[model samples]
Target: MPYLNAAAVKAQDSPGIISVGVLLLFILIALQILNVLRKILMWWIRLLWWVTVGAVLVLFASIIYQRGPEKTVEDALRGARHLSEVWWREYRRWEGYQNLQQQHHVGTSQKSWTSRW
Candidate 1:
């Protein structure tokens, strides 16, 4: 299957090993290129992550500065904590809804099976 030209593979005068050597070289070069591309992707991804985190920090700092004198670092932390709590509650609500939907489906399927019998 590797030799597309059947006559060339079977020929007595042609150098068949040269084709295999070239294929091997091509695969090696392709692997090296892929490795370099992967490294470049990783570098860019890391740089992007740093930039995002830095931007968030700057925004958070600015918000804190804009708040009245009554607001402190603890207030910011508390807000973050409250946000996490709200997200947790929302996740639980979604999970419960999914469970209810699955149960309803199962119940209907069971009813259909009983009716068929």
Candidate 2:
């Protein structure tokens, strides 16, 4: 019963519309400050912008964590990892084939020149 109550509380408190509005408001203010700071500080502003971008990305990720379906996120990450590994293996194989082709071309060219002489 306690666990059920806790789950109910969590479900009820989840961000609906107001929290999203507040998040957007903070983001807008942060962007405006970043623009002004960049104009005043130049390179420092660029560094700040990168930091801001990192923070924003993290915030967006957290928002997704809070809002999105847990199972879907898990499945997506698993699929993404699988795809990346498959792609890397394929890329390495391609590179190996390319190197072999290059070697074959060089060896053939050398043999042809030797035969001509």
Candidate 3:
């Protein structure tokens, strides 16, 4: 009338069942710990990358600040304007000198030709 024999059920070991349950619990705990460690490692890598990018940006800005000609925009513009005016004056002087030289040469050549004739 019963599906299981009472004597056989009583003979089955209980300690083996408990040991299997404990083993599976430990395996699950280990998997959870590994997952947490993987997430932590990914977070650490991202933090390091951002820090490196910040350092590079700071270095570039410092170099530009140190090497720039003028500290202020107004000073830079004024200096550039002064330099352009000086260059323009020098160019006009050079052009006038060139014209005088050409005129002197033409006059000298005309006199030489008339004397030879």
Note each model's CA RMSD in angstroms: 8.3, 27.2, 23.1
Better lDDT candidate (2, 3): 2
- Candidates ranked by TM-score, best first? 1, 3, 2
Stretches of model 2 off by over 4 angstroms after superposition:
1-68, 110-117
Cα-based TM-score, every candidate: 0.53, 0.35, 0.41
lDDT of 1 by residue, 9-86 (tens): 665456677788689999999999999999999999999999999999988778777885368677867999999999
Model 1: residues >4 Å from true position, as ranges? 1-14, 68-117
Q: What lDDT does each candidate get? A: 0.84, 0.84, 0.81
lDDT of 2 at 100: 90
Cα error of candidate 3 at position 67, Å: 1.7
Give the winner by TM-score: 1
Task: Tell how far residue 71 is off in model 2, in angstroms.
Answer: 1.7
Superposition error at 62 for model 3 (Å): 1.3
- The candidate, 1 or 2, that scores higher on TM-score is 1
Candidate 2 least-lDDT 10 residues: 108-117
